[model samples]
Target: MVAPGTLLLLGPLLAALPGLGQGQGQGQGRQRRPPPTQSPLEKVAAQEELSLPQLAGKWFLVGMASHCSYLAEHSHQLEATAVTVTVLDGQSLAISTFRKLDGMCWEIRQRYLPAQAHGRFLLKGRGYGSKVDVVVGETDHSSYAILYYQKGRSISVKLYGRTIRVSDAVVDKFEQRVSAVGLSEDMTYYFPTYGFCDSADEFHILDETKP
Candidate 1:
């Protein structure tokens, strides 16, 4: 069986949920909070003139922040994930993610089609049945990168590092971005630093190629 964290690697399915501002312990008598004037996507901006070559190679999934109810509930079950990037024709991106589920390593391959924006891309298929908007919001192309994923109104932020551990300064920057998107610190989760699956057998690979 595919683990919940595996599904998380592909994309978090969007579902109807309360606003981020609304927290627990608020009763019916408590005043309802007003929603943010700006949507999560609006708060994020992609990097311009993204250098695909510099971004190619292996990177570990270090941290992630999302308001997805499922993720919030299963945060403890997070897995060590790593992604490898390959620049396709200097325009598109070929991504392969490695993670373990049920004692077996699995590899998921997907292509990110370039958008009109230099650092933005669109992901289609993979059983989600809808296009997911992906933006390379921030990355040094060497040490660490912060990416944003959006499907419909749901948005999530991820921090990736070339190594298993990143500096505290990088983590602070990631948290700031997460807050800018209206998500709180409580919604953030750090992935394991060790035991990253570097490869998967042919039978465990799920290749979602696009033409």
Candidate 2:
């Protein structure tokens, strides 16, 4: 079962419609105000071999959550037309995405360094108009951390890996990590259109392998 607070976030996703439109606009207006810029994960991705081509191909959206209701609502509408990751240097990465929502394409160029374990990838970039940190998990054949965004009292999760769905055991372990972070359980939801790991037609593979 999803937590009450999480349910509020998931309500928009399940409905398949944008939610809190006016509220979101107001929030963005407030975000325009200059805030402190320092990221905890900046050092992590830089120290490690955070390669972009290594992240190429299709990635499944396992789950995502954000405190901002507007961002949460927009998340449901997020569909990637194409994702391109390039290793700018030993300590930086350039990520470009063609999204279907606004038909507006954008790219994020980030520099990072290593932080502590837990496979954290710290990053600093200018794309969304602020300093952001992206914490990534250790990479393996099936799973890896995509990125993490943290600002003041809010934090958003972005997990990108080979498949969207995991085995029951893996899901259980991931949930434990999420709970420890004080993130509400129900706040997380998968992108079903992308398909899961066990499915015959995984969106990441199909979309990437296509000519």
Candidate 3:
């Protein structure tokens, strides 16, 4: 089990249930609170001059934040995550997200439009009959990167490190970038590494690819 010290749950607070063996006065659980809501923002502008080829390696998800929306829904159950982006022929990009859920391996695949401009691309598939716009705000081409995506009110901010354990300085840098993008610092959550990739072929690539 992941240690409570390492698990960071941002956004809305979970339901406050009573402690497992508490005194009679402490047995009552508090009423659950509702999650916050976020209004839609204006069109998101992309960063300039991103080299897709350089981002084509594996990256681990270290932290994430989002606007007050369902943007983080698909990712909440996921832990120990990694992403691999490969350029296939010309400007077409092959993207993969690898994660583990309760000790089970899960993956998703999506393809981007051929014309990616200023680090902006429309990804047509996101596992489960979904689509999204991907914006890479900043990346060092290695070490760490900040990724953003939104479709309607669902906005996501992802921080990727070369490995699971990055220095606190790196985390601070990512938080700055997140604030620059208009997200609250309290919403940012840090992810832990479990190193759960069973094998090279363990990642389940979505069958949305053309033969």
Candidate 4:
């Protein structure tokens, strides 16, 4: 015949032992669990709200500005003759582009961004001996920018215009955003390959609203 107080203490201890063992088992089980599998850009893409149709079509490399070595030397030197982006059943995207640099031409093809993030379409490709991540997108109705991350190392920013050219104020604002993103301005260069203008020098702004 045990005292009521003694039984109460013993009962609590016995009940706690099973809970302690279960916790330890769970910890060990978690330790043995495999790491999550995800694409290289999955985490980065998850941070933005991107739309689907906005990513379609050929986005020319109108400009490139960067502090990185490869970009500093050859920024804006490469002109994208053609860019073809297609969305597959709203799940994935396929991209192909033809670019010319120093009289040499090459083609790039890639598949990417089954999931959208931020306000851009993200895709990855390989071209000119480097791995490139292509972010073709628009930040506003009047302006857009494409970021090409090369060699998995450096980035090149290309600004675009909805009309013949971007306004000075728009360019200024765009540059500010670029700088805010931690990119250098001195290393930046411009490329005006296609759209409303034929020659690079013709890359001047015109008011499209005036129709």
In model 3, pairs of residues that clash are none
Please name the candidate that would achieve the greatest lDDT relative to the true structure.
1
- Clash count per candidate: 0, 12, 0, 6
- Where is model 2 more than 4 Å wrong at Cα? 1-57, 74-82, 102-129, 194-211
Ranked by TM-score from best down, the candidates are 1, 3, 4, 2
CA lDDT scores, all candidates in order = 0.86, 0.48, 0.68, 0.51
In candidate 2, what are the lDDT values of residues 9-92, reduced to their tens digit?
A: 875775555433323453453223357565443422421554445655455555565556775666567553333455444434
Note each model's CA RMSD in angstroms. 11.9, 15.9, 15.2, 15.8
Q: Name the better of 2 and 3 by lDDT.
A: 3
lDDT of 1 by residue, 119-168 (tens): 98988856654778889999999999999988877889999999999999
- How far off is residue 75 in model 4, in Å? 4.4
lDDT of 2 at 166: 54
The sequence of per-residue lDDT tens digits that candidate 4 reaches over residues 49-137 is: 45556656655545556667775576545454555557777856665555544544445556665424343444443334333455543
Q: Report the poorest 10 consecutive residues by lDDT, candidate 2.
A: 202-211
Which number leads on TM-score?
1
Q: How would the candidate models be sorted by lDDT, starting from the highest?
A: 1, 3, 4, 2
- Compared with the true structure, model 1 gives a TM-score of 0.79
